[model samples]
Target chain A: MSWLTRAGAAAAVKRNRRAPLLILLLAAVFALAVPRPAPDHVPFGEQQNVETANPLLCVHTLLENEVQEAKIKRSLVLARELGATTIVQFFPWAYHEPSKGRFNWERADRILGHANRQGLQVIARLGLVPAWARPSGPDQPSTLNYLPAESFEDFARYAAAFARRYAEAVKALIIWNEPNLSFEWGYRQVDPAAYARLLRVSYEQVKAANPDMQVLAGALAPTLERRGSAAGLNELEYLSAMYRQGAGDVFDALAIHTYGFRDPPAAEPNRERLNFRRAELLREVMIAHGDGDKPAFITEFGWNDHPRWTSAVRPSQRSAYTIRAYDYAKSNWDWLESLCLWALRYPADLLSYPDNFTLVSADFSKKPIYFALQDYSRQRARSEALWLPPPLDG
Target chain B: MAAAAAGWLKRPIALGLAMLALGAIVAAALVAIIRHAAPPDVRTAFPAGEIVVGVDGSFPPFALDDGETLQGLDIDLARAIARDIDLPARFLNIGYYALHDALISGRVDLLISALRVDPARMDDLRYTASYFDNGFVLITDADDSDANFDALKEARIAYEYASSAESQIRDWEEDGRQLMRRPYELPQYALDALRLEQADAAIVDATTFRLYQSAHMDWSAKSEFISHDPYAIALRIDRVDAWKLVDSALAALKESGELAKIIDRWL
Candidate 1:
């Protein structure tokens, strides 16, 4: 070979040997220069399954936007300590699937994992469509609850994935929240058939994903609006219409939102007055539809005591009425599964009348209702134990 | 290379140019560091040259709309505060429930409604000193010799049935004070009982008493606040400078007796 050619080949061999070392030095410098995120600390260990004494006591936990893991764990622990076996938590589809097909399960997993560890059975309410799922039609405003007709399958797919992912922890799933209210129905005219279709699609998908999951439908808000009103349809008429659309066969259990606005639980139910016993009217509608075999769940029911709100009761009345309502449910309502109170706590101040309905403050301070219910649950447990038949002699 | 650099530095023109470049770089870096290290300006919490105040016009005496114009004690007090701060005051009539949201969402710079200072909202809102007390007070006829509760131990006291005043009277009875408690259907009726000689004294809220006294000048309020629920102005907690300015203005008004004049004008 020529001398120049030989020299070039030797130089190339030397450069190739130094290339990896140079790249390694550069990688080390880059690693030292950039900041790395702190390692994630799993807040909870494996949850111990402990059954609660009061099966009738349930609370709606406002953990949908609670970002802190420690706070989430503490809220669930308090609920379990209050003898609540079931907690109706909102697992919004928009939160989990922010993008079309991509799913971020970090927040959901943290909440579900803590709830499971606290031995709280979750009734996951699924709704709240993502912005991407909302249609870009000129007539529809980009709102939180605006889910167009085409996005039903997309929502169902999210529900199926959520059910399948947390089937072991969450056995009950509420399809939608207060569909009878115009605010919840994307501000469109309240259509029972449309909600029924949404429920049917979700029920089929969830059941297909996890056959053991109990699908709850019809979280109708109690309104006194008559037919053809712009606000909403009366919850009873809406449920009746839902039945007419063959919604009874789709859902495993019926979900009802029965609020005791200013009346006591024993106040007789009327077509015009909204009260706690209004759930009875809903249950009667279910029975008349021949779906009496299915259990009805009070998904949202409570009284607010905000002094300025016209519909609020006194604080003392709220405590007394809440206990009385629970007792009445236990003694009278045989067809009911659980009476989940409207809310346990909020992550922040809602600055509205709904703030007065919470059992605990946003900072996790237990309110009077929390202690009153805890005392009532303990007493009921003792009473039930006393009534238990003596153990048979082996 | 070392000899060449020394030769280049030996020339006065080149050395001056190099030193100038170095000084420029240093000055640029110093400016950048100072800009980065300075604390962010916080006066941007509210819009400039305007002080927006939210008032619930439904509350009478404190803030109410009189057909064509909004007139109340709170309205005048807010205007005075605006004058003191040298800013134009724009009042937004918000509902009582939406008052907190409006302030927090920056829809209004502050609130002058008859909002009680809620401890739960302290984290989100910064409250100035109470402008008025809307709690229950003992009221008697203008000529009653035993005007205060302490002096009227054996006298009959009337309160609205199932009202907070009744509860307070009961609590006092439990504390070993023998009070002849009389009940009326409404607070106005309870005050009317005192006027009509049906009862020696009547316990009613300050708002009710103010409205009643404004209508019938024969009744008079006595005693220190029985149930202390003071109405205060609220602003977003982040508006430190604005809150300081408004709070100082309120303090000056209170010091100058202008607040008392405003309260007396409406009450």
Candidate 2:
């Protein structure tokens, strides 16, 4: 009776072990026989065939404090979250040299230093048009045109010095911003010929300071048509006019500023000229000038989400439109080299005026449009141009 | 509570019968609530009279504080709707986000804050026919000169949380691209970043940028628009009647040429 009971218990243990083994074998067979279905394929609007570069999304930062410092960093962190890689900024001429010949690259150095440490590639535009550069008169805002021809050389010197000092950190130098636009040329007058000279001289100096560094031509503001005021010349006309005025071979890449409005980019009847298609027009002009082979970049282009402002679209619409426009721009990789949006955020008090221009609110609230960008940035890969053929359409 | 109790410890054979009874009771209660909430012809019953609609006055063309008064496209449109409904209209101003809270809390009967119909919001709000379209744009300092998207990888950008701009930015990042720069907010605090030179650029709407430019024409900072936006009126999601009433009112206003006049008055 004892042997029988022991044998029964032993058999029970053996059966328990066999049950587990059988279950394992069954599970393995089931896994092999029925694989999970592949994920559903939703077609992306368009696939990029050209190589795209990854650039950073940047915003202007005002020195306030550690909090402000953290605030700006948070903004950058958000941009990084959206896949921005480079920053385009400025070194204010007025702040750097309030007094003649005395320079304060300390502030500039700190800003640039932090950006570099954060792995941000900076493209500094060296044109604040200091008061010293202007002629003696009532104190007025300094613009690109205000700088005398002599001052252009001085600017070049300063630029050269800055580049030399930060050669390892700073990679690109844009001579000035929107020199073709009257506002940038100085509100007083529009002078392409003079501006060209400034470019020629400044480019030479900047290049001399850093041979390996790439210097971009100043961005040309997009305009409706050729007119009488300072911004009278459309982007293509202004660039061509500058080239006609002998602005050839001054810088490396041609920079442009493009914005699309309610109007279609294509021209129509009755409208003598249309600006909705300013970016395309500028590209056409680049080809006409035989500089079609040159790579083009759009420093700023975007729509507003302001509900109250006259020039703004409803905030809801702004989100939808931004996503579509960005996707379109990204899809058309052949026509664009690099496109940096106008901004990331603005001041709160200025929110009433600058309120609508941000992807997020001044207090760091996430807007619907910002989420759309985050989504796009997450899915998109920057296609690089290993070998791009010269402009064939041109 | 009764229905939940019936669901527990039930015999498999009786489970189906108990579930049916619970469903019938819940349905009966829901029907009773629905009937008591609003009248079927709520719009008609509220005799055409002057109705004051409260709005977040920050939005410009839609609603804004004109220094001393609240006036905007929506204000005028509301007036026109009132007139058609045989009533007068008064404007009450508030903040953008607060407008929604006000409406749901019965502080206001309607909300016109460029509301969009999103799935997540389907439960809390109902929208009328979208009257306008808007798009997001990229904002940068007027002086930025980069030519490619790749150039913006490391820059700082700022946006409001839960805003459309924030979503757009998130979508852009989801493509596995990384920016060296980040996003932030505030120009005055960061003006030093822009002026003394701390930050690179900012992203914002064209109108707000222009408003800032117009105010600070002398400040030397400027913004440009890069993108479109669409808009609609919103009501309490559960108030399907209110939604239909508002939608019909808007349509009637449009047909009577009253909408055009109102739009002209503000926009």
Candidate 3:
């Protein structure tokens, strides 16, 4: 009786351990044998193309935060229908590569696919470091924008991966956005030298992956901040600082953000005043630095029309000034490649003065400026270049 | 008989004192609920000995810097909250994009700008109860009692050509409702059309409609809210003590009717 009871207990214990192992084996085999289906989360409708009269009509779009693929497609359609031939979009590194060596390109694929289908030239802006790449600081946890020196290689690898995958649809890549801003640099002292190193690492990697990829850098914020100020150094001074840090060698083109705030398009450029023609002063900095041969892309620029914002203009004035700003860009700036507006639409209304910067509302309703830009885009011929030849300083 | 009379008197007097004590406790609790006591740790929340508010002073009637002075409904509201907290108020006129960042980085104590209560920002921020609803308002002539959003099957509607009102009307159209739309170049023009009987009803944001009405005091129109976009104050998630002070001050302002008076003075 004792022998039989002891034997049965041992057998039951052994069986309990073997049961989990058996189930795991079966699950592993099942996962391997059955091939997972490709992602078709959103229907890829008919292949479409755009027909636009103005090649310089470009708009920066914020579609990375879009929750629905239908909305992403609809936004790209709106941009193309508005006669914008190009769009600059942000593809956050934290969103795509959340961890080391692992990638989820579903969101990226849908956006690029829809955008390419719509026949729009896409310029990709990459930043927002992944959590694993950001080590906790001494005082507190690091923010998403905090990328350590050790993780620069990891971010470059991710950029190379992006470059290789979307090389067909994307021709240009912006290394970071508003790097001169202390907030964008993770609340630390904004260092152009550190940013130059980041641009170097990313440029080498992405160029190795796709040699033809245009490496753009420095979408500086148009602030009036001075040295030792916390907000950020102004863009004009920031550019000179960047050139001082040997940033000119690593990039193909420069990306600038010039906004018209309480100023007209024809306002004279100064070192202090932030205005639309401020791009001219920035170009002067480039020419002064001997990089005048390189083309520059105005990735983000526009006027706000909110009645209350001190930086805003009237709605009618906003519309007229935006169109005239585009015209001014075409007529004046010779090194300019594309003149993109600040945004097409945000996924949701910011419900502040920033809402007035968009050409379309969150509900997909068009603004009066959309019609203005559309008419302006149509009046010009399709074969026209962005700028007149021989580099006009005026 | 004298002893019995004394016992009866004692019972009633004891019961009367007990009732009075209970009434005092209830009154104190109510006062505690509405008029917040400054936290003992208030110094930790505001070591600067003052309340600093970050406002995007671009929009007028809310908060606008008129070159010589900063004045608006939000400016006065911030002042009243600081007065209730027994602290002097300081304001930083931040830009629209940098408002929340200023609050998070400890540069400002609270944000009193016309910021909507965004659920997305609830992770790092705690919002107080909304003070203003700048939602859309439907404007109809005072005599036109029958016109409203739901009943507008065949009425003529006018709104600013490309404003948020246009989006609402487009949504209504998508739901299979038919109405003749008269898009005006300005919100005031739409109101003018309603005044002239050129349109059956007009739509504009509450703030715009109020500002327009304040200018044209003689015009009478029936107004009803069709949407709600509430504006509230935001504080950092870690600043619970400071948040309580501001929330209680806002509630007191609401109760004392000073908040409405401030809004009326601006509108």
Candidate 4:
């Protein structure tokens, strides 16, 4: 329709060959300047369900920090491959809602989409205070975790939005993580009553949005700090305090954080000791509170194997204890719904002891623990040794 | 004076040279003024007159509590930094995860916990220039011909099974560099395999390699980093004065070779 437009451009280019080069240069610059999405992860394209003999096997995934879609998909794919039927992923309020009323669900949508395609059930763990919700002043230097009481309603609003948006893909919503620790409570005095109030508010809001979505309370951290300690109150005391504050009615299930530390899976737990079986002490507290019928989920549990870290076990023992812990939970804890590991993998290595908690490395290399758990989940017998006995023969 | 000035101004060459010289002098003066004007009030930067340092004292060769007191490279570095800042230093043995909290809460002035400089924490914190690299490295025997990466074309590489070294090997393979991988249960085992000449090369983090070498001082090996995980100090972003002073102290340490001596004393 416009022959002169194209003809004139061709005639001008012929007149000045540098024009074509200049045009190409401009094109290259434009291409480079335009922001590009991380190479879009091609989904599995077919519906896939996790094939597992133990549905209690779950892993908390730190995918909120992942910047690439391909890595997110790969992590979820690995979780599915490991026979994990459920994953506990954080949906930070700060990340989703940077402003008071605004919301950004781009990353959450991608994660849920991939999880759905992989047939993985996601339990969204929500926390972290946005800038608008956090108190700011010259003297008050607050962290992202410094959630004020006034912002509890704002966080509930965010949790409600998240539940409503991904109700189909997500199975449950865990409100807050490790609130028993003072550090998780923004360096303030640990308050169990305050946490229960936040939970109650969030629970009502989330249920109103998606009644089918189960709300879990108190992914309380396991600590030894007593009632007067500045660091934190122990989870047992904190849970009791929550129950007294009427937290038992607000949440449908309980979320607990326990670790094996240096203890074996069968190690007996005591009031003064911490181990894998410390979860039982938490359950007993629930029973005393007359909430024993409510199901519990161990949202964060694992053993660290860092060589220099004081509380860590050996790599072999970490693997053995993890599998044993899963088995023990499946056989003994009928009230427990899921026993999730502390982490699946970090988006990047922290280059510290905490890195030992992951089943996969930052680069996606499956650890021996991953293999061991895969074997346990798939019910495959390990006939061969993991490695050569040693170089002792030399 | 007027006659002399007029005479000098009449000579175009002399006039041009004089103006250029004046301009250079003015520029140098301005640079000196800017650099020296903001001598941070140490009283305001560190009101306690002591640098309270937060460190996870569990990591040996960096910082470890020997049931009496914390000592190691990080501890020494913190003491040296406080000395350079003209303040007495107090140390708090803290958990690794709580290091940042202690700093931000004003409970501690700074953190030197062998922490990798994470970009995500930059929003609320500022990190000093790297003091050490603890990344994965390819270690080969001193006498081995494959000390250089050239032999990786046909090398049987040993590394801790499922560790960062193993992941680095996988990354190399994905980049079209084929490697014969031998994964041991631990990095020490991989180092042992290399020392025994069972493998052409072994890969492990620099910290592990150093600790192993320290245990076997007679064993000679050469290592080069395949990836970089730099450890640095962190301060709250709002503490501009403290950040500036600490950064300069680190630079001074590097310049005087004191930093290298401190690193060598442990690593």
DockQ of each: 0.03, 0.07, 0.13, 0.44
TM-score of each: 0.60, 0.49, 0.82, 0.86
What C-alpha lDDT values do all the predictions have?
A: 0.80, 0.59, 0.86, 0.88
Residue-level lDDT of model 3, residues A130-243, one tens digit each, is: 878987642455566777788889999999999999989897999988988877876667888888899999999999999999999999888888988876788888888889
Task: Give lDDT tens digits, candidate 1, residues A196-291.
Answer: 899899889988999999999988888787889765789999999999999988999888888888899899999889999989999899899999
Interface RMSD for candidates 1 onward, in order: 19.8, 20.3, 14.2, 1.8
In terms of lDDT, which candidate is stronger, 1 or 2?
1
lDDT of 1 by residue, B113-174 (tens): 87778887798889999988888888876666657767768778887654567768878888
Q: In model 2, what lDDT does residue B190 have? A: 30
**Deviating ranges (above 4 Å) for candidate 3:** A1-40, A135-143, A148-150, A380-394, B1-40, B66-69, B143-153, B174-178
RMSD of each: 14.4, 25.0, 11.7, 7.1
TM-score of chain B of each: 0.79, 0.49, 0.83, 0.85
Off by over 4 Å in 1: A1-42, A46-53, A136-140, A380-394, B1-267
lDDT (10s digit) by residue, model 4, range B135-250: 88889989876467766786878887777777677778998997888878878888888888788899988989998998999899999888899999999988988888999999
The numbered model that scores best in DockQ is 4
lDDT of each residue in A276-374, candidate 2, tens digit only? 346666667667878777776666666665444444554445655655655555665365656666666653423243455666666677555666566
Candidate 3: residue pairs that collide: A308-B58, A308-B59, A309-B58, A310-B58
Evaluate model 1: give its TM-score: 0.60
Global Cα lDDT for candidate 1: 0.80
